[model samples]
Target: MDNEKVRLQLYMARCGVASRRKCEEIISQGRVSVNGSVVIQPGTKVDDDDRVTMDGRLIKPTRKNIYIALHKPSKFLCSNEDPDGRSLAIDLISPVIKQRLFNVGRLDYLTSGLIFFTNDGDFAKKMTHPSSHVEKEYVVTTKKEIPEELMENFKKGIYVGGEFFKMKSYKLNGTNSVNIVLEEGKNRELRKVFQSQNINVKKVHRIRIGNVKLTGINSGHFRHLSEREIKSLLRDSSSKNGKYNNKGNRHNIK
Candidate 1:
């Protein structure tokens, strides 16, 4: 093993298993094992040759990273497995994807539209990092007409779950519909934003991520992103290799 080591949870998080926090929970439950022995410590260090498994499934270092964009439909989980047997978005993909892939972020059970899946944990981490400033565009439909002050409040920022979560931009698409851009992907953020105002969010469909958008892809379908799209996203996320530079992740894909 090298002198520098990565935490087990962090490695799993990077492998697209789950978030560091969630991976810790998975560890505590004794679902993780290394070197043919059951291990439950999140801080355990692993080497390049170590064989790590979760629930008896080998999780290898992502050899050839798979990046995909799924036009998720409602009533599906962003997870690889569902104890309740509900549909998983990954199941919608071909079993041929063999690699232990996972959703980059989440879309919950109801919200739908553009969601991402990847085997590259570093890319997932970089994309979700708060510093990435990735822009998430959504189309929301409310149960009722929105108030006039909603835009102003969103523009000025609103206090949600302790921090100020603001909308980078929003457009009124209809009396009960809006297209909003967000820099952060907080849990059920759109719902929370409107819920705090006593407004009911009926539907939320993510339209775009970075420069990639859902075009001509039908619901419940997915497609591998082009190498160009991947580079653009990485570039837009940050100057990973100094190819592109931007002030904030708040900028949209042009």
Candidate 2:
């Protein structure tokens, strides 16, 4: 395995620590060591014989990959560390799942919905990559009636701080709510669109990601993704199909 040396960030990700990007952050913080020496460079490479640790804790690549679907509730942070001591969404699964896992993407502190956690770094990269084109569906509720021009402008696309934001599709749920789908879930994309139109958003909850749905799951709870479900997500990431069928068996946390 001498020729198998890889970058530090990629190694951490393969060990189920976190995504490569998050691993890079950890490395920059001087939390990782190679051969007993703290290595802050994310590009540092290592071979099979090298010893690697994080915060003095030995880390090795996990043999079995795990995938999970979590129904996050509002007010929970989707991060490994929070300065304000707020509730963490990952805390809900850590007690039951022994392996080290991290979130694939983030949900706003006040926005709740279906979130994914996994130990497979490659899978995380596949699902969150810009070219994935994976659809994320959300139900947005507003305090006042949604004007026709607001949805029209959103579907047609608009510029927010020089960043263009648009929705893949939308359907009005009521006078003040609508169901929307987005392929590229930019940071606060929905909120920015509504705010641009002077609309006060009351809630934004994700109901689906790719082929997975949040149905039958309660807030702050999680379930293991079936092999087929995992395969479907990876498959859909490369396909152009906008409709994701969710018929996977749900294994709820007892």
Candidate 3:
């Protein structure tokens, strides 16, 4: 594939070594070598035949793309490395998988549940794109009771730091918890929403994306996403039905 030579950082990301941003750091650190020469430039290009290594370890993309759903437990970093020696979610993955995998989106160290890992860069990019509008559902337990106005405010929308935040829908759970659905959440949007309203969030656990739910998998374990599930993500994200229908499996994504 010399004709399709790509940048070193992107190649490393495709190999699932890390995100393209992290790969740049790895390259700059002189840890990556291509064809027996250390590569320090992110723009350096490599072909399929080129031998590449990171930290003296071979790094290559696998033949088949894999998509995994992890029931991430709280307190695990959603990264390949943690500076403070904290537990990383990658540590829980088995090595039997053929390729390096990177997370689709991040879950906070204290937030846990259905996070995705994949080797297909295009898939990750497409799924995380704002236009995709991939919905995510979370079960959150707040430290204090929610205000009556907060629910209506969420339905209308809230702005923090000039970014608009709104919930697709929410249902109160007992006295201190609520199940909220989001349409393509921004970084820490949920936290910001609750914190802005002076709510103390005790825990946040993602339970659903598209039609996939965190029911069968145990905490700290992972499983493969079904073909239907994957198609559902691509399909549902484009639907016009702008509301959640947890009662039926035949609902469309909007």
Best by TM-score: 2
Each model's lDDT comes to 0.80, 0.87, 0.80
In candidate 1, what residue range of length 10 has the lowest lDDT sum?
245-254
- lDDT (10s digit) by residue, model 2, range 132-217: 67889999999989887778777887788788887878999879999998887788888988888788899999999988999988
Tell me the deviation in Å of residue 135 in model 1.
0.2
What is the per-residue lDDT of model 3 for residues 6-107, given as tens digits with 9 covering 90 to 100? Answer: 999888877877667767898999999998898899999887888999988887765677889999999999987888999988777756565578898799
Residue 244, candidate 2: alpha-carbon lDDT: 26
* lDDT score for residue 133 of model 3: 64
Mark the regions of model 3 whose C-alpha exceeds 4 Å error after superposition. 1-3, 7-9, 19-33, 36-45, 95-98, 161-163, 235-254
By TM-score, how accurate is candidate 2? 0.89
Q: What is the lDDT of residue 72 in candidate 2?
A: 96
- Model 1 Cα lDDT, one tens digit per residue, 1-254: 23346888877766667667678999999999999998988889986678889999877555577888999999999876779999889887757577667788889799999988886767787778766668889999999897758867886777876756678888998789999988766777778888888899989999999889998779988899999999999887776323224444443221
Per-candidate TM vs. native? 0.81, 0.89, 0.79
Alpha-carbon shift of residue 169 in model 2 (angstroms): 0.7
